[model samples]
Target: MNERHEHLGRLLTDAATRLGPGPPWLVLGTVPLDRPTAGSDAVAGGDELRRWVRRHVDVWPAPIGIAAEPPELHPDRTVFTPPGRPAGTYYCELHATGSALGAVQVGTLKESPSDGGEVWAIGEGALAWLTIALLRLLTSYAAHATGWGGAGVEARIIPAAGEGPVVPMEVWNHDGGAYGRAGVRRLATAGTARRTVDLASCLSPALTATARPLVLDLLRRFGLSESRHIDPAGVLRRSHFTGHDELIRTWADTIGVPSAP
Candidate 1:
């Protein structure tokens, strides 16, 4: 792998480490396996992609199992596992064929006991970490291919359940520094709101500052208050964000991190 690929891999690893461990998480993507035509640009693209996947696979955490799916599976096809009381899946679907890129879908799912608020928080953290990794990968890819990054890029988080109004948030990319949006389609549901908060926490510091008031405004609109005294880092360390508030808060605040709002 080249320096750019290696650097991106490190960023992904760092984010995963921050998230720690929770329910089994998986990272899946598609890469061309066929050899490229000799003396064609496809050759270079194929090589770059292969190297990138290699680095990512190498650094994947040992605890989280990798989910292997058939290449023919449609990107839009939903994969649901047996419901776990507080389990969820965070996924990022990237479409790339030949030398062109396509639309991306970044989302999360909460299994059984849909009212399980803790699942939403943990799942949102997973989504944010994955989204950041994807952003870094895209940023690097853009830089290497076009000598520029953060062009023609925008992102928004919508309710995974497709049950409510859509809230759109702007996305920015600055050499992979920080940029993204987190919104929800419905506010009436606690699960949806929790996911929305999870998504918002993934924003760049500047964007987060701009988005905070707006997010807080949305919470009030739903008669919901910002969930405080919950330890996001502890959610990473354990299965839920309820206990160990002081320690998690100390570590997060000292580190300038907040769980939601």
Candidate 2:
């Protein structure tokens, strides 16, 4: 592994340990703002956001909301610990648009430690659901955002915070508004080496020895989301976050994964 890949492995492994027996999904993205939107209200997970997330992201802490201040040094976050399912807590930070804490590089090739401030650690959720949700969230933020950033969006699927198969992917915002300005900022995978297991794993004597990069590549089949982000689809449909159940179900075929019965 190169220095950069090795570095991200460490950062993600540590995050996994902190959020462990975890193989949680981490979705990272940013948008420029006219001004920071910090306040005493739901600066990040405001009611509109809550409704949007609930519809798109399964297993979201249904009442996700953020107080504009601490509990968390992070400016905006909503935390949830289900009754006895402590390991299944839903921890997310959308750092108020202008907060310094929100400034992160999203698994940049430079190898940064500036996350933890922006890591939204979901102790429980499905990868497909999270992937769909990330696209939904990024599209909304991009459509509404006042400006743009160099780094567009990144998503990582980590099998173990200790060490295991990891898959990372990124795409850029082309027009600043939405898709296909230059061309749809298509999703592409990135990692220290494309052979992720070749790098390392903390799993066991067996599993890590023979692991796959993860199902995230399936996300690329949709090109991170052409049906959802681009048109041919209508403007109302393109900008809206609904109408993605088919996408989620197409990629999600869970095994031993619990579901509401």
Candidate 3:
């Protein structure tokens, strides 16, 4: 493997080891925040996404909120909102093309936190869910960077154990906030080589078994297929701290992912 691929693999493996075994948790990655014009739609979409997640994943920790700030930094106390259910708050930062969209971050909540080992367990689960969200967002961003067009980009997760075939959840951008059914037309185009490499680099093997299906289903939903040339282990590595690393580290620390020596 190339240096970047090897490095990311090591990091993921180390993270998995540090996290240990726990309940099957979903790492939903970050969803992209559309520009200010779509602000209200983004809010509705966030709420819908949060609610959909609550249904599929067990043990949601509370005080979940979205922030413009990175997860390592404390969000504005005044802006934090506890979920209707009781729990400590965890925040996920949203982005679009490397710029922070503070105005769009207002008033988004995920779930409330629980206590004790349960909190750690839940945090790990939340990390998985967040990971998925981030991957999807990154995929969309990469597609745009590669010159793909179209509004209404989204990724959906249906738990493996859940009753039906897991399909991509339709995300409404400028489509009047309507959720589309699975098997819809492609929203984002097939990822470019760079996009594929970045995705492979960021995704850990430990997560592949679960995350792979979600990704494929999303591609299918978008009317695209996985690129044949993409090597999950050959992508060039940059700093792991770029993109969603701060949030990943914040959650990893909470769940006890080992720090690099």
Models 1 onward score TM values of 0.32, 0.35, 0.23
- Put down candidate 2 lDDT per residue, 21-52, tens digits, no spaces: 33233433333223332322323445555544
Q: What would the per-residue lDDT of candidate 3 be over residues 1-261, giving only the tens digit for each residue?
A: 244334333322322222212122122222222223422222222444344323322221222344322233223112212343211222222332311111101111122122111111112122223444344333333333222322222222221122333222221111123322222342212111111233322333332333444445444443444411112432212123224344544443443223221
- Misplaced by over 4 Å in model 3 are 17-21, 26-70, 73-132, 138-261
**How do the residues 1-261 of candidate 1 rate in per-residue lDDT, one tens digit apiece?**
243334333333332332212332323222222222333232132334445533443332222211222122344222212233222333322233221121123333332232333222222333333333333333333333333212222222332233344332221111123222222322322221111122223223332232333333333433434412222232222222223334433433432334342
Deviation of model 3 at 241, angstroms: 33
Q: In model 2, state the lDDT of residue 69.
A: 20
- The lDDT for every candidate, in the order shown, is 0.29, 0.30, 0.28
Query: Backbone clashes in each candidate structure, one number apiece?
Result: 0, 3, 29
Sorted on TM-score, best first, the list reads: 2, 1, 3
The residue ranges of model 2 lying beyond 4 angstroms of the native Cα positions read 1-18, 24-26, 31-52, 55-90, 98-129, 138-151, 162-261
What is candidate 1's CA lDDT for residue 73? 31
